[model samples]
Target: MVRVAERLDAVAAGLAEQEGPEAHAALADRTIEALRALRDEAGAADWTAAAVPAVRAHAVGALMQVCPLTRYAFARPRGYPGDAGLLDLIYRHPDADGALAEASAAGRAAYAVTSGTAPCAAVRERRRILAGAIDRAAAERPGAAVLAVACGHLREAEISAGLRDGRVGRLLATDQDRESLARVADRADAPAVATRRLSVRDFIAAKATAEAEIGRFDLVYAAGLYDYLDDRIAARLTRKLFGLLRPGGRLLVGNFLTGLREEAYMDAVMDWQLIYRTQAQIRAFAAEISEVDLAGANYWADSAACVGYLELEHA
Candidate 1:
């Protein structure tokens, strides 16, 4: 069941919707982990084979109620046709696009949160939108700060070419993955930007962060972590992020677009591949804290993935 899509094409051939949220819902935790590992590999031995890791991992961590995919899977990677389609669907939503315009009009910029460099064209598009977002805000704030989470070695470089221009301010990048962080020092232009190592896991203790970050920030931007977390966990994290913002600070969530809904059996990328979230789901989550501005994303020519960028603010 972990590989619901293993024979999905055959199964989906005759049906309008052959996927379901339940096909692999019953997988055991251990089996789910193994499946995730397999999914990650894409089995050079078997391209036809697929697996879901996030679903299985969540089966253990949150009683299967809040299963999250591995980090990499949340935002679909480039070159994967399966992922590209779903991202397309996400960014084309009419309601979603309208919300983005509203946010852009309000004059809020984005601060991208991630583990490192974005090689995907879709990610590049995501960055462009975020850069625009920050640019909008900078028009009023003089120097808008964009925060990034990247490896130590690559941290400086992410800043120099990525956000060092006069328009963008503070290319704060870091990474929690030590091994990945170590490579930062090896890159030629890596030491140009400011960097640190901070993981979403390290932020599990975010209740404490709220007291300090709230009211001080203009926005909290995270591009790829949403699909990995369940709605409940996303809610908790959103609340924490919300608290950290100044009264009007905003939070942006990034979801890869493949032109598909990505609703059920989403663990194929990890315990699953990408954990899909609807604009409705995001808006619902945002409503729990404050107002949400949802928007469909455009393509990043470099990475080749479709994306959706959302902005939710504290009223």
Candidate 2:
């Protein structure tokens, strides 16, 4: 552990001295590789509980000084990891410019590297996949109704051609955070998009009532919700969302895959934790749904193979 901390400290020092994009990129690669090696060496033996604190205390504390992205994640201003604000930074959204501007030159350089990681790439790809799914659903059934559970800012809607061109009948973008919902409601496509303040617990508790009130949807998706749910809750939610689908409608859910190279850094340094799942584990979330209720199910990984998606079609 001491050796690992010393190595990380050296990396931090190198990053501080380096200037320009190439230098930062090289140092970022070294930092990621070092964390991956540390995680491998620690194995899976309660590393989060035992190893993370030591690594953070010894080295990552200083590393975060240079990496504002890691600092924001560690700080978690919205009182939770992976908040929409942090995601904005990851997305390189203009809303994140103020936060980036607040960082020092070295910190901004580090942000560029952290925001460009393979995991971040996977997240960006996830947004693209959701947009494409919405467009496809609208194309298959013109004026399709869609539901986006835990929709953070609904950035995908910005690029969704269906929503842009008025092909989508309605898109109910729901989230626990009013701020996130407000952003979604402020979009140019606000007329076609509706915002609702709904949490997972609220949605689950009102499942029977929700269906009648929200009506059936041609497409339902929770892009980032499953990352925080356990198997039981995930399965239950899957069944509920699947129930909301209209005949021939589709439900899509995404989860980060296990064995991510950034897992250790995210866990220990950024204080971000996720319930990463295997392809089989993702499929198992649909176990409660009756075979007679479904038509087909499929799973695919993002381009970086860091995120896996499960898509189910209703009969």
TM for every model, in the order presented, reads 0.48, 0.93
- List candidate 1 segments past 4 Å from native: 1-121, 149-162, 167-169, 179-193, 207-215, 257-272, 290-306
Candidate 2 residues 90-155, lDDT tens each?
A: 888888899888877767777777888899988888889999999999999999999999999888
Cα lDDT over the full model 1: 0.42
Residue pairs of candidate 2 with colliding backbone atoms? none
Q: Report the alpha-carbon TM-score of model 2 versus the true structure.
A: 0.93
**C-alpha RMSD between model 1 and the true structure:** 15.5
The residue-by-residue lDDT of candidate 1 on 72-165, one tens digit each, is 2343343332232232222332322443354321111110111111323454466456656555545645555545432223322332333444
